[model samples]
Target: MHHRRPKNLRKPLLGGGAFLLLAALNAPAAVSFAEQRYHAYKISRPAYQRQYGSWARVEVPAEYRVNAIHAALLHTGKVLLIAGSGNSQKNFDAGTFDTVLWDPVANTFKKVPTPEDFFCSGHSQLPDGRLLVAGGTARYEILDGEVRKAGGGMRVKNESPDKAVTLKKGTVFRSPSGIEYVSKTDVTVPKATREFEVSYFGNGAMKPWKTKVTAAEARVFVEAVEEGPQALTTQAAQYEVVGLHGEDADNVYGLAQKLTTEKQDFQGIRSAYEFDPKAEKYVPVDPMRDARWYPTLVTLQDGRVLAVSGLNDVGDVVPGDNEIYDPKTRKWTKGPTRYFPTYPALFLTRGGKLLYTGSNAGYGPADKGREPGLWDLEKNTFTGLGGLTDPDQLETSASLILPPAQDQKVMVLGGGGVGESEKSTARTSVVDLSKDSPVFTDGPDLPQGTRYLSSVLMPDDTVFTSGGSGDYRGRGGSDVLKAQFYDPGTNAFTEAAEPTVGRNYHSEALLLPDGRVATFGSDPLYGDRDNTKLGTFERRVEVFTPPALHRGGANRPVLGNGPAEPGADGRATFATEDAGRIAAARLMRPGAVTHTTDVEQRSVALELTRGRDGRSVTVDVPDDRTLVPPGWYMLFVTDGDGVPSVARWIRVK
Candidate 1:
């Protein structure tokens, strides 16, 4: 029906027609907005969350937020977050080390008094429920062009067999060419060793022995007293020890190689401490013999911690000067020498050997010590394992003993090329150490090549892996926000809830006592896609609730009135109303993680027996000390539906 319109109405009709045309042209954008809103609603629904899980960004109080470079789950049900200078040069200069204690249950935070810059430290759970934290940043790295002074390592010699020599920090060393360098740290050179050997003559008389004396040496970082090119030296030189005379002057001397205004790598400290969860403070212990940055501390079967691989005091790879810390003695002794890149992923096996998964984070020759192997600690032998895909891309990879650690299987997941290379891989490999000839076999690939990926062991017998970047330190805005669940039984991955935050270098994910996973830290190189702006350290901590937690109501089994301390191979009875549904029990080692390496987290299966009363469950702890290291563990009972109860702290003596 064609109808004539009045002149006044014609203009309004024309405007309305134009509006309709514009809305029609932008239909895709309107539809997209509506679809996004619907997707958000759908995921928030109980039904959808029960299947795919859910993620919630934790609202950390602004004052308590920290970089969280290191995270450890304590027996107190609180997480310790250490950010020691937080990778910030300004913070280091200001001496602003930080640590925050977060109680997930109470949602409260407390600031800790950090004594040193533990920015690149190594930590492990101690048998006494303390956290042994060792090594840290002694000096920040100075780039080549920014280096203002000439510095290098100096070897101080004590030629006197009678008395040792102590060189103070400001001790001056005069080079042969008259350039003076000052010691940057105190060093004590041991007295020369004197040995006498006797030879026995044929059946009757003893021949006189000759005495041998060997000079003792100690190394210390030295810097030219003066800055700039005038202090630079390109030749190795012997330096006269200042403030000495006569025999003392001759007995003490300094030797150093070329000291130049070159790039200075981050140096490490020899300081070590044990964080007491009960007292909520770091207690200083005996220092290590060698300074270390980016070290890895693994607990031995005897409960001693083996500290290995890091940059030493002079900003050099530690030259395999590993040491062991005896918790009982509170001292460190020389360990068997074995070189590895910094923060190597080493797991202790049931046979007391360490399984090196060929996964490391930064600092070493790409060709050396990058092979996957089994290491004999007593004999100092390494047996290399083969068949790992993308062998060259093991740096920043995540390695873990797969669930039911008694199976003696370890897996390596996702890695990148050495250093800041742009290369990454999606490879996943598993090595069953129980095999006659253990070699890594390829598992399912990740959705994309990733680095700094965090793998957390869930009580439900699956691994939750999430948050990594496609490039080095998330350059080019390459942070991968995806997450997945890896089923060791199926040797495959299934998609899980996606993380909202991007975690890359220096990130960590740990399973909380409640079965949810808490993630922290991400220090990207740049904030923008174009890599133009410096990236801020991610201070926001995110928690992921796995599908098992969202299946229905809070019908989780509750552990009540269990033994506070139980001996290995002993049975402990726990009261729980849901004991009848308890299908399995596990002793989960609390996580102490940093730099994507956590040898501390493992789920050891316990033999479970439901009581006849249907209100109690008795579980037997394994007798093997290597299989179940002595420490405080979270006792978790899972139902047939894979729902885990809130953990109860139990000490395995």
Candidate 2:
């Protein structure tokens, strides 16, 4: 039965008064003070009662090691967890790259060796059931020391000994190091003695340098023949450094430096690899044309994958260059595509165009490469969409192309300002691309603001959103405990049970075979948001079972047999316990989700025909790969009572 809102209450009411108002409003249209006020001005509305769900905290094996900086649900039903550095620059430098295959069925973790620091990398599931992991952190930034500003820029000395001087008296100068320098003015200095020494800053303090410079060089270094109170005094040189401001030509940026000095590894690698789940090892593939870190790997309609954004070999944005990896050729080729921002939430539209949702996973400049639009591959044109309220908050925001691929409505949910400097948002917006001109309008708002939210579309047509921070990267005690469900049918959000632990950046959640959702990973600020050294890394996994599964008894539809791989005819046979009562069938591509968006995730309703025996059925798969891309999908059969069956994995080839 459809629930209707009373005439007087067109919109939901807020607070304790909502319950009483909803009861009274349930009556026929009538004039009242409450109704008058509701009509006069829009008020903060109360959230709908949550379509309930339950969460189970799964114990992780102790040997799992690092947090899941990246995760994906593979076709083999095992989750791929990768944490190259595990969010620690020290570990990354130590060649501490780790990859693990987590088997949900066995509740066990198995180690897999990866080539490089795939930390902060991007990946997509290939048509052959392998995952293509691209780009990774090659080096780390070291905060050497503050260089004194001089000559309108930074000054350094050409001294070979690399002296750290507090200018006793002259103008500051720079040398081959290209590090910053501070300028100081002083009268004159008598002669260099044990009284003055070169000093450097390290471990949070200025230490004296062991080596001493000649009096002639020292006089030229400080440019001071006389010394006084206003005069910059020198401390003993504690250290000799090649670079301080990170401005060295070899460093690329002021930061990107090689963490490892091994002969086999450089700072960044242009290498790519495919994970072979069968052998539990990563096999090397053809290297990418350019090295990337934090790029977005999206599987295209043609079964090839597109790699976009991320820091290049020089530790800068990859510029306008984008590449496509063909599974057939097992190679990457430069594509005729324009640059989208690093890690842009790119969705493959039904029209085969890539849709940049304007949401990104915290890389590149805030003002550049972000625009909500459809990127056409053939014509290389982008038709932009406007009317979004907070484009800035789109960073780390989550978005989804609503279920049943036929409907081109896309919805963007909670996000926040770039990086950890800003607050999270509760705002929600939706755009219907089916219209001639699509513009985002306000949808139901989140109960509270959040960022880094993982919104997974469930089999029942409701979106299950979990694992986000109320603040940026789960800091400020902003770990969101509660989960929620979004029902397109009601166009509202309902609260669900919160998970056992806090989840933030590097966290992930995806639908499981038993109709439950698995959630794990939160490596924010190395897991120590609070100053207390007792910080803990979130490695334990949690599973959430929606209310639909709790309906109990034998009412759940059970599929007996179906084609593991369906061809162009798109026919798959199945014997279901609830065959006669089967209401509908759906083929949902299992999501290979990470960050905030799942590029290849989608759901398509299948045409079902019940066999005459009332114990068998035939499903018509989508012949058009455009509608149902050639990939693995979860085939679900929903009974008359609206309960979905445990999905049968199938390949829409």
lDDT of 2 by residue, 15-103 (tens): 55788887787655555666857633332121211136566677776787567877787778888888887767678768878888888
Model 1, which residues run further than 4 Å from truth? Answer: 1-36, 197-210, 567-569
Please, what is the whole-model Cα lDDT of each candidate in the order they appear? Answer: 0.93, 0.70
- TM-score of each prediction: 0.94, 0.74
lDDT by residue for model 1 over 1-653, one digit each (tens)? 99888899999999999999999999999999999899789879988778889999888889999998999999999999999999999999999999999999999999999999999999999999999999999789989898877998888999999999998889999988788999877888999999998888899789888888899998888888888687888777789988999999999999887788889899999999999999999999999999999999999888999999999988999999899999999999999999999999999999899999999998999988899999999999999999999999999999999999999999999999999999999999999999999889999999999999999999988999999999999999999989999999999999987888999998999999999999999999899999999999999989999998898358887888878877454789988888888889889999999999999999999999888989998999887889988899998888898999989999886
Model 1 local distance difference test score:
0.93
- Per-model C-alpha RMSD: 3.3, 17.5
Question: Model 1, residue 87: what's the lDDT?
Answer: 95
Model 2, position 348: C-alpha lDDT score:
81
lDDT of residue 442 for candidate 1: 96
